[model samples]
Target: MEQLARLEDLPQTYIDHLTQSNLVPLWPSLRNVLPPKQPVPLTKATAWHYRDIKPLLLEAGELTPIEKAERRVLVLANPGHGLENMKATSSIYLGMQLLLPNEWAPSHRHTPNAVRLVVEGKGAFTTVEGQKCIMEHGDLILTPSGLWHEHGHDGDEPVIWLDVLDLPLVYYMEASYVEGGDVQQVQGTDLGHHYAKGVVPTVHFVRQNANFPLLRYAWTDTKNVLDALAADANHQAPAQVSFINPETGQDCQNIIGYSAIRVAPNETVQLTRRSAAQIFHVIEGQLSITVNSDHFDLARSDTACASCFAQIDLINRSEQPAYVFVADEAPLQKKLGLYSTRPRSV
Candidate 1:
């Protein structure tokens, strides 16, 4: 009764009633829970080196067969979330997957949308709804939510790729679902037929449909477009381009966005902050990125994450040009009217 009287002078009967109803008065905790400013648990900018993890991935491949493992991926867990969760940032998940020669990852689908940026090797391919798309170094491939896809390697060497997904968003929404395909192996390899027929067939088997018409964004074509843009004298920051849907001319998916940035030797690109967080992977050469006060020096096959609303700058410090692949959730943020950017003075 005395403690109840001291708790903001609430009556003993009232306090007892609140406890019996499994409810606590909010006045005591309101200030801590609802502060004046939006409080976000900021994730620090971090980097991962492919060279350091390559051996462990190779060893895992030798020890565990693809048949038993289902998918052989090593997640790049964020330090902010601790090792329990596989998220690379608050809203994104990043991983490195390895597929040895003649091995295959069985077909399956999930609610989270994913994008694959090839890091090394070649002759590996992913099949989306029976359409096979070849995977090579620097290629970008999309695996939209709930799409039946499988991976296989026919090359002599093991193939490795960076996998970026909007899984945290799916988990947050409580919309996660997974289903395994009936067929274990991909049957179609009609790459020439897709062009010869002049019609790309859609996957009719899955319940959830994909917004983008195309799945494969070949590195050769992407590089050619970037090269043409760089040839212009007006081109600044070397070049920057987004992978868009051929039919819609928007981002490939509504949940995620993919972009490529190139920087010439000894050049720096200044960019303002935006509401969407970004993760950058260095494809070639040496690069430096400063996100607000945090600085990251990245080499080939390294990755860095910049939090939302952090002013960022990218610099190519090597003699050769640098290529970077970026993944973000700007599309979703824009759809929700939560995306904003402010220009920074150079």
Candidate 2:
């Protein structure tokens, strides 16, 4: 391997001439962009504990009312990305959003696809497009791109949900923007029941829906699926299921891929390192997460993030099985032909 030239070694007059012409050399900074073996990711192995965050999040609610704060949230910022950037990974934006009793986050839609993994409380619901999706302890709700959505809480307790969005990628492409709208009159019940077993209504005229037909994925149903997968006597593979569009069978969203993974008691599952940055949020029992060399002991509502090509291992050292909700940038990377595992052979 040869050493690359440094920008500081360049002649001052040449630098000034290039700067004046709005041009610069790539050789001096080539490795910064195209590194030796793997990507030099700004994202690092990071974890956000729910215990430390709940108090601050509640304080945010008391300090700022719903009217003043459209969405009361505390961003889970990764230090590698810089706290100011508010990014959990290279492409994902994570925030713990709160909606107090009788409070409503006004109706608005944005260009970036967003999903909410319900963390606590029950009386909160998010209306996306026209369906009213009730928020439960572990429900996964979608508010895809360009869709009208609003959050409202009917119960007395404070409701909090982890919001996952592709804001950084959309904002980078200059396509991220939001539009405010009047309060939504939630039209129908969530579409989850209709496709409960992946069965489309045949006798009745199925309501024609837009790109997103089913928005709410109940955790009970997802956990059941994972249990069934684990019970299989045929294979010993990782018990995981991808969240997909019921209609077209594609990824639930265009940019990010979401999944639910179950680790049986006293098991250690090595999640393969891929070309997409990933996040894992604990939904059930405890998990000991390892991202490369860093280890994170996660409880309910705790989250861990790993950059691309970083080794991740999830361990369930307890007596009960552990369930995790996962999100990654694979959809976008695959679409752009930049997704892959680390090469095994040199």
Candidate 3:
């Protein structure tokens, strides 16, 4: 090859001439540097989402002492998304969060994919798609991605959760539209009672003997399913088990990516990095997570544990077990309908 060189011996004139001819054309133009072109403001009212807390997580002693009663978040997208310059979807993604004791974000929803996870709150709620669900902590509540949903505090304490929407997704598609519900919110108690009254109730899906598939999952029932897995001889999962729609047997929440949980509990889970970058949020307990030796001490509402295709280890130090929510494309893209665990190739 050509001899190795250093800049010290090069003449100033030669360096200047070389840089001008080689670099200026690569500089971004004024148009590229300017902000995105603002389209004509739509006449329809645009809704808003909030992330500031009624009380900071560091404020209260009890909330911070045991690390309970606080709303901590890893992601929040509204009014903007991280990759705004790359895509143009009207959908906006939000990671709404709340902690305990009187910190209610109030009732509101718009024509966007609004989804929430009851991170660590009891008696929190969302009335959506004309149905109501009491969001117990760890419950994945869906507002039909675009139906009317509102969050509130009815119990004695505060509740916090993550609210994710697809506004940016829509913005990229350039097919975003907005329309408000005729009624801002429906009564939660009424919806709750209406569902409870029916015996062997089946509203969304018909109940077959083995495949009564309407509800994606109930945490208690899933726990039992996991218990069965534990009883099995080969329960390593090396991969994780995902929730599937029983009727169609497809993954739930089409655009939300795929949701899966790993029960390694102080073990290592290998993953391959690809185009799909995920934001993993811890749902319960504490963990010592290391993404290739870049360690993260994560607990409930603490979102320090995330990586894309790096070898990750979760070490639990708490007396109780830990649960984590990982978002990634189903069946690793490289494997195509399968989870992949291979080392990165240089």
Query: Which candidate leads in TM-score?
Result: 2
Q: Which stretches of candidate 3 lie over 4 Å from their true place?
A: 1-94, 99-111, 176-178, 182-217, 262-265, 272-274, 305-308, 317-320, 329-346
What tens-digit string does per-residue lDDT give for candidate 2 at 231-302? 998857699999998877899999999999999999999877799999999999998998888999999999
Answer with 2 or 3, whichever has the higher TM-score. Answer: 2
Of the candidates numbered 1 and 2, which has the greater lDDT value?
2
Better of 1 and 2 by TM-score: 2
Q: Candidate 3's C-alpha lDDT?
A: 0.48
Highest lDDT against the true fold, candidate:
2
Query: Each model's TM-score?
Result: 0.85, 0.96, 0.60
Q: For residues 1-346, could you state the per-residue lDDT of candidate 3 as single tens digits?
A: 2333546456778768879888433223333444243222211111122213324532442445323422244344322223333211222244546544444433444544545766555766655544556777666665544445545557776566666555555565675665544434444232222222123346563322223123223455444555466457777654345555444455555554545454545544555544343545666666666655566666565543233344556676655656666654433244454344455554
Identify the superior model by lDDT, candidate 1 or candidate 3: 1
Across 27-49, the per-residue lDDT of candidate 1 in tens digits comes to 66565566444435456677888
Cα-based lDDT for every prediction: 0.81, 0.91, 0.48
Q: What are the clash counts of all predictions, listed in order?
A: 0, 0, 26
